[model samples]
Target chain A: MSDMSLATPRAYRRPSTRRIQVLALLTALVAGLILLTLSCGRGCLAPGDVFAALTGAPGADASFVVSELRLPRAVLGLVAGLSFGLGGVAFQVMLRNPLASPDIIGISASAGAAAVFAIVILSVDGWLVSLIAVVAGLGVALLIWTLSARRGAAGARLILIGIGISAMLDSITSYVLLEAPAWDRAEALRWLTGSLNGAQLTQAIPVAGALLIFGGLLAFTARDLEALRLGDDTAQALGVRADGTRLRVTLAAVGLVAIATAATGPIAFVAFLSGPIAARLLPGAKGLLLGAALVGAFLVIAGDFVGQFLLPARLPVGVVTGAVGAPFLLYLIIRANKNGGTL
Target chain B: MMRAERPHRFAGFAILLGLLVLTVGLSLTVGARAVPWDEVWAGLLGQIDSIGAAAVAVRVPRTALAVLAGGALGLAGAVMQGISRNPLADPGILGVNAGAALFVVIGIAWFDISGAQNFLWLGIAGAGLTAVFVYLVGATGQGGATPLKLTLAGTATSVAVSAFIIAVVLPRNDIAGSVQSWQVGGVGGARFDTLLPAVPFAVVGLLLSLASARVLNALALGEELATGLGQSVALGRLMAAAGAVVLCGTATALCGPIGFVGLVVPHLCRMIAGVDYKLVLPLSTLAGASMLGLSDVLGRVVARPNELDVGIVTAFVGAPFFIWTVRNNRMRGL
Candidate 1:
């Protein structure tokens, strides 16, 4: 074991140094993206005015663009990305599989399905819809847990069942879209693909609150998550309440995912991509909670910025993430195969 | 050897007979215009068939299309699972459906191909290309095409293709109706022409699939063992995947990418009859046809004036059944 550890020089080093470096780099990237986002749209708000508008200056169009349009989106991206990144970390840690993400495990799809049902079918308010989404998200997570309980929710089985459930819900969502009128179908489809466009302060409020609550909960459990990296039995032997910790973290992760999915439709691959990016950047990180959250936020903000300004017409943030993330996913698969197919 | 498999084969034969009866009954009696049993019998017998040509034309083709498309999808799914040796595998997973939909979107946007028959070959070509691409990408390294590797490659490629489809098609309002209908997946627009073009393709694909089933069963054990047993594992996998692509592409060209039935029906069939592909494959075809036929009928009946797409109705049924199945037994690894 010592020899094996010695062979992988980077694995045994203190993680905080790498963590700080990654966090610093991500913060810089996000700062640059914010500047770019502010500068691109009509009239090119100067950095001084952008800051002033963000601080709520009165009677300024730059204020309207910064505060109403860009700020909400940027803030939402930060929160949602953090939620997705942290949620992905929690799932990957608990399930002991790198491939595990909220979307892959059916939680985001469930939340999206529930939210859609509430909006289109029940005609509920947005906040109420989010509430129902959280409930449904937890419902799905619980359902998967119960179904896989007898066999102890092996990583592959969890993913397979999640895929099945996700497919079923996606089909149902499609059915709902079909049943809706043409205009409603278009709107629903847009929402399903996830966009940060036209996010209001009200929507941002709940998302922010959920993020703070869930983020804090996840941070508190980070050490236990590191323990979980060892096998369940070994972790238990090391005085970890593996089952209780897993259950709490899983619920908290679902809460974060539901909040994020409610804020932005599943926003393709943010959850799946963030953890690996963090892992790559912070090579010896004990737990990827903070780094993953930062990376996720960066991906979302970057994707949103590109979609808003780079494209001829503003595309959904999800589209940009998907376009960017798909190639990365392919790379991950190839890398995994090259590394002997363990992932 | 074939004689020793007789009872299981006989059970499949019995299920097929039952499915046939159920399908006929579903077609004759259930629909928006609820015809009486006597009238249905007369219509079948060509005695009181003075009904409007619209009703006869609509009902007959719809029912026939459901059976044909459903059988094709189920057969395709079983074949895909067999070849991939992955229970989670489906034609959609391989990007065949996405590829067909993408080209169909392009065809509608670019060429104005209104009729389904004109687009059938395009769909087949698209699906075949995507399958080949996935195979090539998956088989790139020394590990060669493991089931999990294929699934991951296929999934990633499908997402990229689907994103491309949405990006291109969503902004074009003129083709929105066509694209939306295709996406929902239905037999609502099926005609005799659509059914006819797919027949030869489905037949050939089905035959190829059955011929490769025994080899698939051996391959399922593991690639090395199957190779040791004198099976050309790579060749068998390619043939099986080709069969699946042909079956799915042809069917999805006729119907839209109808969901759930392909992914679920095979497992249900396998549960009823043990996992002998010879029996499972044929029974899956029958079960798929019956399930889709019944779902289409239910769609017509449930919504009254407006019809639900058969794809939607299947989820209402299939999702619960799937959840129940997972709850009841231990699902194997992918």
Candidate 2:
């Protein structure tokens, strides 16, 4: 492990205002990247055409591709990515564990399980199924939180309980699938792995609305989240309502995760990787909420774009994300181990 | 001083023996059919006429498969924990399951291999190749096969292989169906004929692990200390890992990736038997067999006539147990 190098204390030194300027620049860059992702895809819609389509242009093909096909998918990706990024940051900060994410903690699986059950057993509409998924996801999160709370929710204990819950949910899902018809099984599998294909405007609207609501709530608690990084006692000492902040954060994370999962299925690893990527990119930042959201959006959009055009036969966005995220997870593990750090 | 440990050790041994008997009994009696205890006993003892021919065939084959698969998984778990020195380590963590699954998928997708026997070797080869790949990957990292490095490497390999499996097989619905079910893990499709080649591998692996139990105990103290104690740390690790690969590969190939028994059972055994591999290894085997057999029975009973796969049943039970163990500090340290 590398020795910690402490900076010498300087009394009352006023920092330059350049940090704000830099952040503003980075934000612009991220926005530009998002716009670029929207324009560059299989649809071959020019930037002007996409803008014209967005502004109610007269061209039919441009409007159809942009409005009917590309727009919904892009908007869903943006919202889902924001949800995952924000949720991941909140979870990691609240739990004080980098590996803490909706997917890893069984939230996504629970949502997927609920959605599958709804699809296969109850025969409900997709929206009602997604609502059930949100409830199921929250249920799993509450269970893990309650179970790990007794020991003060240490990172390891939380992870262990999460893993256990995940495994159980997975098994139950499998058991359900086994009893389901073959077509249902295939549908469930597709949903479980996650896909952005055929994401209609209806799904996109609710997901986007959820992201806006929850993302705003997360932004409101940004300062508390930053304080949380200094540990619970310190955050509490700093007049932050630690428990309340944790609860709200947990709820927000779950809400975001559930909505995203409902819309796009459980796209794996974006929620897990986004926070770390943001933290790494924006070193010395007090709050990672905005950064994580940007990174999450970047990852999802990039992943979707690659999935669409990278291979001869287009793969699902989830597959591409898994392929990318698996190596990143390994890197995190190795880095943690090398530093004698716990994940 | 060493003599003082004998009574506790003996008690562990007794418990292990009891578990072995119980597992055998449970495996025979519990299945799709409601075979009474007396009939099960008669069937085991060659008094098969007591039961109908159909009942005998179904119960005997299923029971034997359970015991064989369960026992193999248990032993494999012990070997993996021994080699990795991590309580969380399981056969699946080393990519053995994924590797086997990938090959089986490949066999189904490309070769159109259908029967259990035809794909058995493919599973084994896949498992072996994955183990070797994980080992090489872990070794290439800064520290050679340190617990975390090995785990990371194994996990990465598993993901990569699993991705490959999904990519290749998902487009084809038939192969996807076969691969998806197997990926969930099970002991249901196993037959004695399918278990034949794997049995020798399991036996040899188990024996090798048992023989190296004391060495493992020393190695567990830390590799540097083991080296200082005149043990060849590298050789000990190699033997233990090879033993793990064989047992895990064979078990996965035969039964298609039974997950948490290896993860949860060894920790339970360690808590009961107190960390001496001499005791932990054998106790883990018995405990693992019992756990899987009992889970298998529950799988049958839970759905009644429908029947759940044993792997899912084990996960449903094992995950909670693993959580409880971790919470209780029983699975502390590793």
Candidate 3:
């Protein structure tokens, strides 16, 4: 055993050096993206004016735009993006599949469908719709989990089932939108496309809370997740209750994603893309929860900035992320295939 | 295996064909305006120029379009699954639907193109180009487009294409209302003249799909086994993929990119007819036509005065079945 261990020569870091370096880089990127999002919008404010507004100093027009509009929008993007990132990484590590993000697993689609149904059919507004969305997201995830568990909880079967459910939920959403009144059509489309347009400070409160709670739980379980990544039998041999850790991690991840969806209407591929990108940046990092969350935040803030200012016509954050993430997804697929790795 | 199964398979085919005829008849008889069987029969015989007969006459084109599109999709789907050797594969998984959608959106938003004929052309062009692009992207890589790689490539193309569609459609509210209905997949607004050009394409696709079954059978045994059998595995895959693209492109044009028929019907057929491509291909075609026709009929019944899109109804029907398929199969890797 000693000779085998010596021959293998597994590399170990203090978790201080590698993780901190990567985290610092992500922190810098997130800060920069937030600043860019705040400064670049319609009636664009100068950096000095934006910073002043953020600090609660008075500057009439700049203050109004920055405080009322850009602040909430940016804050929501930051919080929701972090939730998605953390939730996404949790699922990837737990399930051991890069494609096992919340959006791909029917959670986001079900949430979107419920929200659209509330908006178009029930005529419910604001908080009530968000409540329904969170419940529905959890309900759908539970359903997929139960159904896929019939054969044993293989990730491939779960993903296939999730894709099927997502497609069905999408059809339901499209049907509701089709029957919606003209007045509701634009609002529905905007929400469906996942915009930060018309974001309110009140909306950010629950999202931030969910992020804190679930993100904390996920951080606590990060060590277990790293062990789980070594395979279930090995994890159990290491004195980890593999199933318990997986359940706790998945529940927290689902909750985070549900709340994020309620806030941002399933912003395209933020969750789907963030963990993979974070892994690429911090190669061989354990768990990737923090890095992934930060990457998600960056994607959302930068995507929002680009959609609002870079394009000729204003687009949604979801659209920008989708456009950017899809090519990355393709590249990942190709690279994974070449390396004979399961995506 | 072939000789032993031939008699029983022929019997099953006969039953399916009979069901297809019944579905066609029901499709003619039921709609927004329910017409009596006698009047429909008279309309068929051209025995009367009555008002009810005119309604029956109108139903003919739509029903025919359903049959053509459904058969093409099912056949293409069977071929796709056989070639990819992945049960999850379907015609839409080839990037056809997304490509067609993108082009149609472009046509409406930028070129101001309208009318069914123009939409048909644009859809075909989009689907064909997207399929070719995905194939090239998947095939050029180190392992030459394994099932997983192809599926990923198709999904990525779909995501990017839909994003482009949203980007184009969002700012232009003028096209939103029309494009919304078109994107959902339907046969409600099809005209005989609009469907004319697609008929030849569908027919050719169907013929090629049927002819490629032997190749699919060999291909299904894995590339090494197929090559050992002295088959040009790459050429076979190319032919099968091309046939699928043509069938899928035509179907999308005729009926706004219907989902699940291509994905679901083939699986259903395989369950009844077993896994041989010879039985699966033809059975899928029959079952597909019947399924779409019946769904369209059900769509009319569900919403009463207001109709649900057949696409939505199929999803409602197919989702559970798809889940069941996944749950039952142990899903031996791709």
TM-score of 3: 0.89
| Per-residue lDDT of model 1, residues B28-85, tens digit only | 5677776666666666665656563245446777788888888878888898778766
Task: Give model 3's docking category.
Answer: medium
Q: lDDT by residue for model 1 over A81-161, one digit each (tens)?
A: 888888987887677666667877788889998877777788787679779999999999988887766656754556656
What is the Å distance of residue A78 in model 1 from its true position?
2.3
lDDT of 3 by residue, B1-334 (tens): 2342667778769988998999998888888777777788887776667877877887788888888888888888888788777676666656677798788789889998977767767877887798778876766557776655676677778778877888998898877766767777888887788888777777777887888888888887878999999988888778777778778877876677677787788887766677788888999999889888989888887777778888788878887877776676543343
Put down candidate 2 lDDT per residue, B180-249, tens digits, no spaces. Answer: 7777776666556766756677777788778788778888888888889998878877787767666766
- The candidate that achieves the highest lDDT relative to the unseen native structure: 3
Candidate 3: residue pairs that collide: none
TM-score of chain B of 3: 0.88
The TM-score each candidate achieves on chain A is: 0.90, 0.86, 0.89
TM-score for each model: 0.88, 0.85, 0.89
Candidate 1 docking classification: acceptable
- Could you give the DockQ of candidate 1? 0.41
Error of 2 at B207 (Å): 2.5
lDDT of 1: 0.75
Over all chains combined, what TM-score does candidate 2 have? Answer: 0.85
Evaluation by lDDT, superior candidate among 2 and 3: 3
Native-to-model Cα distance after best TM-score fit, residue A294 in candidate 3, in Å:
1.3
Question: How many residue pairs collide in each prediction?
Answer: 0, 0, 0
